[model samples]
Target: MRKGKLYLIPTVIAEETQAVVIPPHILQALPGIQYFLAEDIRTARRYLSSLKVYESIEPLIFEVLNKNTKADQLKKFFEPVFQGNDLGILSESGCPGVADPGSLAVKFAHEHDIQVVPLVGPSSILLALMASGMNGQRFAFHGYLPIDGKDASAIVKTLEKESRSKNQTQIFIETPYRNNTLMAVLMKSLADDTQLCIAVDVTGKDESIRSYSVKKWKSIPVTFPKSPAIFLFLSH
Candidate 1:
């Protein structure tokens, strides 16, 4: 039996900006896919609606594949594809398999020799790096830093030192609600001369991407109010 392919679909990071962020070709591909493994079904459905891709979303089969999903449970998600039906892996935001649980499905697909296709879309990590004026060639995305204050601060200092010695751009993110707290810790922990880039609300109307030294950041009073953001670090 001919096995089906898995499309790694990219969803917009922000709401109501589907037309501006998602490509038309990706939208056109949605109709042909009958099954999808998404981190959040509601968000995925809303995204598809924003693009007007599907006349009705009731027929689509969406399987939950978030952080809570277990490894053993992943097998069921591939059942449709095993039956020769193409499937899509959709993340809550950005491309799948990057800082998202969808990677587990992609890993399974690879193990079973299933064809995988990744569509183009906006990634806040890449977008932030592009706008930060940092070393794009040598950069590391560390996902999220520790939530504990002491542990998170230590990791911040370590990354800063690594950035200086290796000349590598360090990138990481924080949960939306903790954005301000993380920002505070970063300013307090990093060296005065170290450069920090805060990319806030990428692909959204209130988008802000600014790179400043720790001293400058200290001088300026800023607040990140529960918005998605990416932080980049480069030390001289």
Candidate 2:
């Protein structure tokens, strides 16, 4: 029997922007997918509803695969796919396997030779990078920096130094609630001439993307609203 393909479906980063961010091809493929491995079942269901691909969501099967999902349980999520039913892997936000736990399932699929397909959609990291006016050819995305004050500050300085020497862009994110604190640390830790780009609420109606020197940032009284954001910087 032929094995079913594992689709890495990308979803909108922000809420209420499906029509703007998700491609038509992804929506058109939804009606045929009955089994899904999602980071959050409720969020996944809501996204499917937004697509309106099916008359009803009752027949859809969703299995959780968040940070808490264990290695032992990963194999089970692919059983339906092995039985000749294609499975969709949905992340809580953006594309699956990009800083999301959905990578675990994709890695498993590869080990077992299951065909994998990735559908394009909004990715805050890429969107932010594109708008940052920084080094796009050579950039590194450090998912999230350390939460501890001293540690975070130290890492920020190290990244800045690396950026200066290599002409590379460093990108990172923080929890929404801790965004301001991270911003403050970044402004204080980086050199005056180092360029900083803060991309906030990407793809949302209130989207904002700006780049400035650390000195300029310190001169301005900026506040980061409690929302998803991506921060990038280049020391050169």
RMSD of each: 1.1, 0.9
**Model 2 steric clash total:** 0
TM-score per model over all chains: 0.97, 0.98
lDDT of 1: 0.91
Model 2 lDDT at residue 223: 91
Judged by lDDT against the true structure, how good is candidate 2? 0.92
Residue 185 of model 2, lDDT score? 90
Best by lDDT: 2
lDDT of 2 by residue, 1-236 (tens): 78889999998888789888889999888788899999889989988988898999988999999899898997788889888999999988899999899989988999999999999888999999999999999999998999898899999999999999999999998899999999989977999999999999999988989999989999989898999999999998
* Model 2 residue 134 distance off true place after TM-score fit, in angstroms: 0.4
Total clashes, candidate 1? 0
Please tell me which predicted candidate would have the highest TM-score against the true structure: 2
Error of 2 at 34 (Å): 0.4
